[model samples]
Target chain A: MAKVSKEELLHIANLADLNIKEDEIDNYLKNLQDILNFANIVNNANTDGLGETIGENDQCNVFRKDEVKEFKDNELLLANAKEQERNMFKIPKVIQ
Target chain B: MDITNLTVHELQEKLAKQELTSEEIVQAYVNRINAKEKDVKAFVTTLCDEALKEAKEIDEKRKNGEKLSSLAGIPIGIKDNMCTKGVKTTCSSRMLENFVAPYNATVVEKLNEENLIDLGKLNMDEFAMGASTEYSYFKKTCNPWNLKTVPGGSSGGSAAAVAANLVPWALGSDTGGSIRQPSSFCGVVGLKPTYGLVSRYGLVAFASSLDQIGPITKDVRDSAMLLNIIAGHDERDTTSYNMQKKDYTKTLNGNVKGLKIGIPKEYFGEGINEEVKAKLEEAIETYKKLGAEVEEFSLDIAQYALATYYIIACAEASSNLGRFDGIRYGYRTENYTNLKELYKNSRSEGFGPEVKRRIILGTYVLSSGYYDAYYKKAQQVRTLVKKEFDKAFEKYDVLLTPTSPTVAFEMGTRSENPLEMYLADICTVSVNIAGLPGISIPCGVNGDNMPIGMQLIGNKFEEEKILNAAYTFEQEYKFREKYQPEFKG
Candidate 1:
């Protein structure tokens, strides 16, 4: 069973966009390696040529009539917002 | 007037007979929710006031002698993962903690049209990831029979509430064995409709391809009734089937005589606990006595199901959950210098360990170099698994196995060993792999007095046959008749 090196773990975490605390890195690396090693058993199976299906129901291109739909009151919708502006949600500005 | 205890079919029957008003039925269930839910921790929120208001309108319509649908006034637990137009549909996760859906799921809309009372949201595995309700960010759902053990999850709360008679039935989504395993542990009927049978528009995606919303109830009758309400085509859900739904209740009485029931040798293997095996063997004998021909069968691809399922489910989950980053809105971090840091920090803090583990594994599989060996290969194996089932079904009308290898273990027992815990799903994963319709019916009590369930699998779109065999076994076995949940106030 190959273990994920500390450097590999850090690299994968970076790709996942996660920054593991330095103290947490070692254990996360070991645990993740265990899971990966465990998953290698799946490699044992031979999947030759089956097309990938994202979901069941062979149907595609279902169309709904486009129409206005009433939903919750806007007052209730933004009631819990941390910040609000002009009856819309406000968040940390991206370009700041 | 405790109609919450009444099966939906019976409640519908009573409403049709004018013996109970819709308001009265809804109020009955609402009252039960008020009194009992505090103990079971089944619901994330109780919508009794809202439900009663709707119930009153339903009553007014019926008083004017309007046409009443079968689902009208029947209270049903909607798993938190399904979106409700104005209700909080949180997926029992902190990520969606403050998120209330703006649109209803396709099934929820169908139930609304059918006049089913929303019993608010039942808790679930955060993002439908775990096999135990323990993973929910909300309060843990307790098994009604024994509070110490888990209710079996990510549909744990759905099964627990139903078993406690807090509500007669509820809707649940099955990915892997979420519905069936929990049903077995909670001692209720849980059906995973043939994929695409019921629409998944509102179900929060775990593994989109593997997810199917279905009914978890005290009996198969309610499963059929709920199926009737939720099964149909919806433009919003492209995967929803356009196939004909022949009132599933009608199929309940279909004769199982001469039906070929396949018994897989792999399912009854050395790994199965002795107690679960005894009950399953008894169930087979009972089916034989009921005039169904039992035949031995093999699914050559069975051994590979879990591995394929994990790779496929995790890969999809990794992508589906990508929508939850701290951007358009789910959980956003209190502090982050930039978008990248925000996404990373918020998700790392938000998702539980099991979920993070899966996302990482899935991410790796779908990553550039490993896609063929992991993701693509798993897809191919999934095909082989499906092909194997197609062959088996050609020789048999239905397949039977123990729903789970053992009864519910201690809540935290397998929490440490993810591999050991995943093994618990061994018998049930194949049905999901084949995208076949399957139902878990109570067989009898294990000597320890825990519930045991027997699974019945049928060919895709052949739910009628599975229901036929299950109904026959249910009727003849009479185990469920004596299977009372030992709940105390």
Candidate 2:
């Protein structure tokens, strides 16, 4: 089993897009190490020929008719938006 | 009369015969919520005025000689994770704390079609992540059995609400024993239906493949009734199975004679509390007395289930929760200077620590250089886990186990140790892993006076068998009536 160093924990947190604070990194590393260790138990299970289960059922490529429909509740949809302008979500500047 | 104590079936009979009005039933539950909610902290929001208005509308329809479903005028609560259009579905997280849903969850829509009065949104572990409501960004829901102890979660508020009689029933989603564990802790009935039995269109995703919504009720019959209304396929949810419709209530004939029951011996091993194990043994004896054939069997994959469950569920969660990136609805951080910082800051400020931990772990396992070792290995073991259930089901009709290793522990005891908290879900996580239907019914109470729940697991879509077996045991044991919680407000 590999120990999750503080650097690794921060790297993982960065990939997950979570801002791990300087003070909170140690706590997270400790907890993450414990959890990863627990999760390592699966490495011992003998599953050589088994295929992975993506879901419970056998359905694949489930599609619906590509027809346009009108939704009359644009305001309701945008009601929770942090900022809205002309029925579109207003976000911070993207693309420098 | 204490109308709040009556089950949904009894209340339905009264409503049908004009002995009670839907408005009166709504008022009764609202009054109970008003009196007891402060202590229990079950609801994130209560729709008292709205519920009364809907109840009155139902009464008017009934007086006009219009036919209605049996669930019409019945009061129910929804877990905060399920969308209810025009109502805030917060998932007890600050991330979506003020986000009003644009559409109703499919289950909520089905309940609306039945004209069932939705009392409000019940609290849960934030993003349905934790084993206790202590992790909720909103208020922590306490066990009705004891104020200091936790109501097992992430469906804590749903179970606590029903156990406290705040509502006759409530909807709860289970990924890893979220429904059944809390139901066990609070001495209520919680069912995690077969994964595809119910549609997940409007439910806020935690783990798409494993998450399923079911009922939390005061008794087994109410569970069946709620399942009947909510279980069906929808085109919106591709995973929803096209099952032949059956009235779940019709199977509650209380006859389990010659039923084949298996007790997974591994579930009763070390770490199971003595009182809880004793109660399970007593429940097995009850099934035997009812002429059900009970025997012990080995489900060896049980030990690895928790590990596999955490890996898969978190991996799915990390990807699913990626949608809350501050561009759309949900919380936004004012501390960011650019888009990338915006994403990180908003999530860090929004989600709780446990949610962050899972997200980080998920990202790590699914990240490059680790996917094959961690994530893929867990999936392969998942196949092995499902095969074990399939092998067990070939010989036995249903499997019995303790819903949790221990009764509700005092709050703050396990929350500090995240691993210890995760261990609480050991007995319940495997059911979600295998995509099977599992129900937790009150077996008896422990010496601490906290409730002990016995889990009855069925093969995929074989809910009726477990329901029949549970009904027979419910009729004979009558555990709820004998050990009612006294919440003196």
Candidate 3:
């Protein structure tokens, strides 16, 4: 098995858009190592020429007919929103 | 009947006959919850006033001689992962503690149409990761059997609620053993219907492909009644099957005579507690007496199921949980100088220990360099696991196994060790990986006197067959009459 170095953990966390604290890097590395050890067991199984099982059973199109439908209560729809700005959901600005 | 101990069938009968009012039933359960929920910590949010209001409407409808749905006037507990409109839908994580759902889950919506009473949103593991439900950011839910033991989780609160008789039945999401293990621990019937049998449009995503909403009830028939209402195709859920709905009660009358039940040998050996194994063997003998045949089968791929499930479930969770940033109506920390720090600080402080652990593990497995070796390999092994079941089901009508290897351990037993808790799901992960329907029915009590569940696995979209087998066994075993806990409150 290839070694998962400290630099690799940071790189993966970046890809996942997760910001891990500097001190918790060691703990994450150790946890990652244990998980890898467990995943290694699956490596021993023979899965040659097998298709991946992505979703459960099968995925079929469940669509509705295009037509006008009665709308739900707008007030009820907006009741759970923390910030309702002009009938729209508002969120903190995302950094570029 | 004590409101907690009465099954949905009995409750509905009383309401239909005007012997009891829906409002009266709702008040009874709410009053019962008032006396007990403080020590149990099973509810994250209780719809006390809302439930009473809906119950009054249901009773008024009945008085007007209007048709009522099967679940009408029944009180059902919901897992925190399932969205209840206008109610807090925290997945027992600090990240979404203040988050309330704008819309209801399809199951919840259907139950609402029937004017069923909503008791509350039950507790769960943070982001539905851990097995003991101890990883929840909120206070852990204590098992009703013994306050010290854990109610096996992700859906621990749902199972604990039903078992403790807090409600007649509950809706829970099972990704792997979440519903079944806790049901086994709490001594109730928990079913994980064939993937896509029930809609997942509004269930908070843990692992989209692995999750299915099903009922945890006091008996097999109650499970059937709940499934009859919730099982159907929904246009909003792409994975839901476009299959015709059936009256599940019809299948219970079908005899299990000449039915072949496959007993996978992989589940019986190693790690399985001796008491659980003995009870399983005894149940098999009982099946033979009832004219059913039990035979041995092999699922070599099952040994790798847990490994595959964690990789795939975590990979999906890593992606699904991306929607919970400080923005989008969850927790927000304004103490940060920049937008990036705001997102980071909020999630870092908001999520619990278990959710963070899974995110890190999932991110690593699905990372570019290791994706093929870990995630891809697990997916391939998953096919092998499903192939094993398909090969077995060709001859056998259903498969049986121990729902959980050991009985419920003490509350603080595996809290510190995450891997040990993960292993408790070894028997259950294969069913989820295969995407087949499964049910965990209480077979008997172990030497320790805690309930033990025997599982049944059926072919895809064959929830009725699984329910038939459980109902048949329930009638013969009389497991419903064996309530061990004190539910007086």
Candidate 4:
């Protein structure tokens, strides 16, 4: 069975952009390990000559006319934003 | 008139005859919701006022002798994941709890065009993740059969509402077994259409490739009726197929003679409850009595289906969920020092434990060093599973199996162990993996008198065959009245 340690769990949480609380780490680790072990069953599958399936169908490169239809609900669109200024989403300082 | 007990078609007939007004129908459902919502806990929001307003307008249109769609004036609920313009489309998560949609999902739009009254948004597992609705950030939806038992999820609310007759029908999305399994537990008809048959636009994505919105209703005919209205091409959803238009209800002739039904032995193995097995066997015997050929076959790829489904579903979810950064929409955290911390903290605070677990597992499998061992291997197995289904379909018209291993379990029974919870999806996930259409209808009652469901899976775009077969079985079984949820609470 696959096992996830504290360090590994922390690293994964970081990669996934999730801030795990200090107390929840052990629980997360144990659950992650259990899920990974369950997922490890795929390794036993006979996929010697099988190709990976990324989607259900093969019709790709679907192009549409780049028509710019104006959406009239700008205020409604901005209603859910955490912080908005000058019709744009306001964010924390990015440049150091 | 017991408006709540009537099916969609019956309601339509009454409306046409002026036997019942849309206002009366909507008011009846509102009363039903008021009475049942506390125990069933099915809806996140009830649009009683809006539905009444629209129902009144639909009645006006009809009185003016204006031609309208057959579905006009019927009340229905939408699963919370589907966006309804100007309504909060929370996927039963804190992240999107207060986020109102700017546009309606295609299915919702289609229903709106038909003038079907939107009763409200139904609850579901957070981001449609867990097998039980207990993972919902809001209230947990209990099975209407017994309030102590869980409504199988993540479309638990949808199934429970229909079973309890809160609405004639509702919409649900299936990524894994979200729709069908819940319908099985709640004893309603749930249909997951062929993946691209219905547009996924405005559906909050969990796994883009696997997700498809479908119907949960009281009977096979209602499912077919709803599918007829929703199953069409939409340009916005590029993945939506542009097939020749099909009126699904036209094919429900209830004739399954000479139909080849394959029973997958893997689905009926050790973990399945003996009673559930007996119920399915009884259903198969009924099918045989209808002159349909029944045979058992080994769908060996079933062993790897669950693993493949998790890997792909989680990987896609990890990528898809990255959109909820707390900047544009969804929940935002106050405790953050910088931009990176903002992203991390908002997600951590907004999401529930099960959602976090899936995101973590999803990220882990797709991360470096483990990608080939887990994600890629799982994808390969997915292809193999699909190929195996294709091979099976060549010989059989449809595959019949139990919708779930058991009936509705007690609320807290499987919540503690996530793996135990996932096993509930074992019978239905392979249909999604293969992108085929499958329907669940009640076959009989278990020892506890809880409903047991049998699944009928068809090849891609072969829903008509399954519907014909399901309709045939449904007519004979007539379990709808016998096993109907009586609201135990």
Candidate 5:
């Protein structure tokens, strides 16, 4: 069975960019570990000759001719933005 | 006449004959929703005024002698995951609670083209994650069959809306049995087309590889008619299959003679309730009497499908949902001093517990050290599962299995156990894993009088075959009449 520590849970949560609460960590850890333990059964299967299936269809590299289609709806696109500046989404400063 | 009780085809004929105007039909459905919405909790938003206006427009066009499509004047309940311009398309999540889509989804565009009136946005699991609507950040949708039980989700409201007669038909998305399981629970017809058969453009992404929008309706013919409108190639969706568009309704001849059907032994094993099994047995007997050859088959690799599905689905979800980090168009944290805190707090506050759990698990599996062990291994196993289905289809034209292991459990019965909730998808997920078409039609009712559904799974792009087979059983059985809910309206 897979055992996940609180620190590991926090680290994974950090990687996922989620701010898990201190009280919720134990529950997340138990559930994540149980799911992982169940997922570990894949190791028992014989995959020596198998190829990974990223998608199900036979068609790949689908493309269309390069053509410009004007959206003409920037106001609508930015309608849901919490904060906007000059019709662009405004976010907190990232640079130090 | 109670117009809301009519199927899409029946309503279409009535509208075509000018016996009923689209305006009157819309009014009837609106009245039904007003009467039963409190009990069913099926809609996240109801477009009553807009639907009536659109219905009047259809009537106006008919007066001008304009051609009408099959879906003209039909009221469709769209699952909230699909984008609808000028409509609040909350994926039943707090993150998108206030988000109004700027554009319509591909299917929504097609429905609009066909002049189908949008009844409103139906409720679903938060971003299509859970097997029950209990995970919805919005109101819980109860089964119309029994208000005490869950309407199986993440398309629970879509199924419930149809079953409760709030809408004649609805659109739903299935990643891993999201459409089929709920349709089973609600005693309706739902189809999850082959992965690329229908375009996924504008669907709020949960697992891109597995998600496909499908039709949920009162009967098989309606399922086919809706599929006819939605199934096709799209330039926006890269994964959309480049195949000839099929008239799915044309294939429903109610003929299943000499068809080879396989009953997977693995699906009938442990965890299935006895009553559900009995119902499945009776369905098999019906198939046998329809001149279809039935035999027991084994899909040994299906045991690993659920585990692989979670790993792959969650991993893709972790990546796909990364776009919702409070910057672009979703929920933003109110108080954040820095950018890092902004992303963390917004995501943390925006997502529910189940979404957080899946994101964390996905992050772990796709992380550096575990990539090969979990994510890569799961992909290889997915290939194996697909190969098994391909081999089975070589001999059998279609496969039959129970849509869900059991009937709808009580609202809170399995909510606390996430593993138990995931196991409820055992009978249906492999079809998605293999990229096959599957339809769930109500076959019988269990001891509690809840509906039991039998799933018809077809090989890739074989929706025609499955629809015909389901139509045969639907004609022979008329299962809906046996289990119709007594709506008080």
Candidate 6:
């Protein structure tokens, strides 16, 4: 069984960019540990001489014409934005 | 005939004969929804006015003697995961509670092109994550057969709505058995098309590789009808197959004589309820009577499927859901001092516990140190599972299994334990992992009278074979007559 420590849990949360509250970490730790332990069964399976399957279908490298099509409606695109300026999404400032 | 009770084909027949106008049909369904919404709780948004207006237009076209498609004017429900332009496609999460789609999903557009009346957005697990609707941020959908039991999810509402006769048919997306399990629990027919058989453009992503939109309906033929309309290529979805268009309805010839069927012992093993297993056995016997060759087979890699599914699905989910960072769409935190806090607090506050847990688990598997051990290894195992199915398909036209290990349990029965909750998907996830077409048809009922579903899995692009096999069984057995929900409305 894979044991997940508190520090590792917090580090994972950080990597996923999720904010875990201090008290909630323990619950997350226990649940994640349980899931990981269950998921560890894959390690025992013999995967030798097997290829990875990233997708199910055989079709690949499908390309469309390089012509640009107009969406023509920026208002609709920006409709769900929390804040917008001049039809563009407004976000917290970066690059101090 | 009651407008709400008519199948897609029956309703289309009536519409063509002008026995009932589209407005009248839409009103009847709305009335049913209004009466049963309190009990079934199947919809997140009901488009009553919009549907009525569209129904009137169809009626106008019918009066002019304009040619109409088979699905024209039939009311159907859309699972909340599929985007409908200007309608709230919440995926049953607080994160997208107020978010309205700017565009229609490809399937929604196809439905619109057929002039099908849209009833509403059906309830589902938040981002199609859980086996039961209990994980939904909205109200849990109750099984129409018995209110005490849960409707299987994350397409719970899709199956429940059809079972309650709220809609004759509804769309559902299956990733790890969301469509089939829920349909099994709710006593309806659900079909998950082979991955890329149906376009996934504009579907709210939850484990993209596994997710394929399908139909949940009262019977197998209605599933075939809906599949005919939605199964096609779209350049918008890069993964969408470029195969020639198929009329899935043509496959329902109801001939399964000499069809090869493999019964996977792993699916019928221990954890399955005795009654459910008996029902499946009886179904197998019925298949033999229909002249289909049935043989017991072993899928050795079956035990490893759940672990592989969770790792791959959650890992993909973590990457896909990263788009919900309070920037472009969905919920944004009210108070955040910086961009980092904006991403973190919004996701933490917006998403429910199950969604967060999956995200965390997904992140862990895909993280630097564990990537090769968990995520990559799961993919390799996925290849093995697919290969096993491929080998089985060489001898069999379709693989048969119980859709769920047990019939629908009481609400909150497995919610406390995440592992127990995932076990409900034991029989259905491997199909998604292998990206094969599978269907769940109600075979019989358990002791508690809840429905038990038997699954028919086919090779890739072999939906026709499974559909015909299910059609044959449905014709001979008449499972629908055994248990009918008494709709008080």
lDDT of 4 by residue, B1-489 (tens): 689999999998998888999999999999999888999999999999999999899889888989898778899999999999988999999999999999889899899889898999999999999888999999999899999999999999999999999988999999989999999999999999998999999999999999999999999999999999899999998889989999888988888889999998988898999999999999999999999999999997665899889888999999999999999999999998999999999999999988889989999999988999999999899889999999999999999999999999998988999988988888988888889999999999987889999999999999999999999999988886676677775
**Which candidate number has the best DockQ?**
4
How close is every model to the real structure, measured as TM-score? 0.93, 0.99, 0.95, 0.99, 0.99, 0.98
lDDT of 3 by residue, B1-489 (tens): 576678888887776677888888888888878888876788888888888888888878878988877568778899998888788888998888877777888998888877777889999988888888898888888888777888899899999888877888999889988989999988899999988889998899999989988999999999998898899988788888888898888879747899899888989999999999998899999889998988997777656999999899988888888776676567777667666676677777778767877877888888777889989899889889888888998999999999999888998888877778889999999999988889999889887678888999999888888899998888988886865654322
Worst 10 residues of 6 chain B by lDDT: B480-489
Kindly report the fnat of each predicted structure, to 2 decimals.
0.44, 0.82, 0.58, 0.92, 0.78, 0.85
Chain A vs. true chain A, TM-score per candidate? 0.74, 0.90, 0.71, 0.89, 0.90, 0.91
Local distance difference test scores for all models: 0.81, 0.92, 0.84, 0.92, 0.91, 0.90
Name the 10 consecutive residues with the lowest summed lDDT in model 6 chain A.
Answer: A55-64
Supply candidate 5's per-residue lDDT for B84.
97
Residue-level lDDT of model 5, residues A11-40, one tens digit each, is 888988898777877788778888888889
- Top model number, lDDT: 2
Candidate number that wins on lDDT, 3 or 6: 6
Can you list the residue pairs that collide in candidate 3? Answer: none
Each candidate's root-mean-square deviation in Å? 2.6, 1.1, 2.4, 1.0, 1.3, 1.4
lDDT of 5 by residue, B1-489 (tens): 778889999998987788899999999999998899999999999999999999998888888988888558878899999999999999999999999998999999999999899999999999999999999998999898889899999999999999999999999999999999999999999999999989999899999999999999999999999999999999899999988888888888888889999999988888889999998999999999999999998887656999999999999999999998888788999989998899999999999989988998898999988999999999999989998898999999999999999998889998887888998898888888899999999999977789999999999999999999999999999987666875322
The best-first sequence of candidates by lDDT reads 2, 4, 5, 6, 3, 1
Clashes of each: 1, 0, 0, 0, 0, 0
Q: What's the residue-level lDDT of B329 in candidate 4?
A: 97
The residue pairs found clashing in candidate 2 are none
Error of 6 at B325 (Å): 1.0
Instruction: Candidate 4: give the TM-score of chain A.
Output: 0.89
Is 1 or 3 the stronger prediction by TM-score? 3
